[model samples]
Target: MEKLELTPPPAILFALEPLRAMADYVASLAPASQPLPQGDGHPVIVFPGLGVSGYATEGLRERLKELNYEVHDWEQGVNQWPDTEFDGFLDLLSEQLKRIHSQNGRPISLIGWSLGGVYARELAKTHPKLVRQAITLATPFADQPNSTHAGWLFTLLNGGVSPMDEALLRRLSIDPAVPCTSVYSPSDGVVGWAGCVGTESEYHRNIEVDNVSHWGMLHNPEVLRVVARLLAEHRRGTFRTLLDTCVTKLL
Candidate 1:
């Protein structure tokens, strides 16, 4: 097993090369068929990670739609730098959740990738009634320090937002009460592997995949399978994993 690195390589190209390979590998493992259900279903909002473009996630959204999920892309354009802008993102998220609740007449399920996962968790925190289930792929707790080359660079550039302050972390980290699942990999070429762990408790789940890079999990077939299964389980009113005892059925 490759050890996760907190320090990013100096070369930008080198750091990103592994990500490209991972993306290609994930693309190769695409499932042959993703069947959609035949009727109206709960709304599912898909949030892609930071710096990711719409093109990167089009396939994933299509797959969700195939599975009959009413998928909505978090159309905030490219997720370049939300931390710096802080653009009332929480407010926008609140509005979106309210709209989804009103439109669907129920809570919405969220599948957020990377930083988008942070947004998804915040939604659950602010409007728990509007979120049925929240799943995050490679999204770190706000309190944890990120380990990407860019993450370090941004921290250096921004003076100091250390990822290891206990008080600060407690303030920023997501609570496990929102039925959250975090998917991560030890071999992730991006983000500190340790930062991927969910809050220590029964309500949160931390799924570790082997050898998959951070970017790769976005489109990895097995990851998609787990996501689809979880969504289906939620639909059947049996969403809790065996690992978590809290079961709330809403149909």
Candidate 2:
């Protein structure tokens, strides 16, 4: 993996979140396929970005529900990271995964945004059998620890306890055992885009979107469309079709 320079000047673009939100709202008005792509109603849990509450992902949760998937919120309120201790947070997530798996009698999919994406990837690594797939939005797992635009804020919020230590960063760089899709944008102003790239493999793929804001990823219509398509493919076991369709759409 290539090292990314975390220059603060470019990161100031994150302040344009309001503009991105407006654009996302307009994009959402465009018509997509009716009924979208139906899923098998398998359970899905969405995790919010750092310092954000589950409500931040309500739009995505609703969209997933429209696809007939059993979507769920993290229900852990704001993601305060080390406040709950990393191990405790993982335990909570693990418990939720187990409960959902037991109830649905099948593995669950995880869709995480930003820091939440980190958690999703780690969870899948720890318990691949419990996860059907893992999808991340603009997550910076490939770069060295602490090399993020939000490092300052993250440090202040966590009381100087960095979540991305050397060991954890090394673990995050490896591909998870389950099917994984990383949805990212070069225009993202929060995390370095290079760090968001997933190592391509039989089960790992990266989808790059154009002109998408880091914060707008959860509500970006194009991103949502690809996510819905990926979920549908997973449900239907259409890997070849997915590859062809993604190539066409992305081109």
Best by lDDT: 2
- Listed per candidate, the RMSD to the true structure in angstroms reads 5.6, 2.6
Give me the runs in candidate 2 sitting further than 4 Å from their true place. Answer: 1-12, 33-35, 235-245, 249-251
- Write model 2 residue lDDT over 1-251, tens digit each, in one string: 34456433264566775687678777777787444668888899999998899989998999899889999998889876756657777887899899888999888889999889988998888888898888899888786545567777787786776666777777787878777889988878778778888667767888888888888898788888878877776542323346567657544
Q: What's model 2's overall lDDT?
A: 0.79
TM-score of each: 0.76, 0.89
Score residue 19 of candidate 1 by CA lDDT. 66
lDDT of 1 by residue, 173-227 (tens): 6563566778776666656556667554545667776656667776776667667
In model 2, what lDDT does residue 12 have?
Answer: 54
Q: Which ten residues in a row have the lowest lDDT in candidate 1?
A: 242-251
In order of listing, the candidates' clash counts read 2, 0
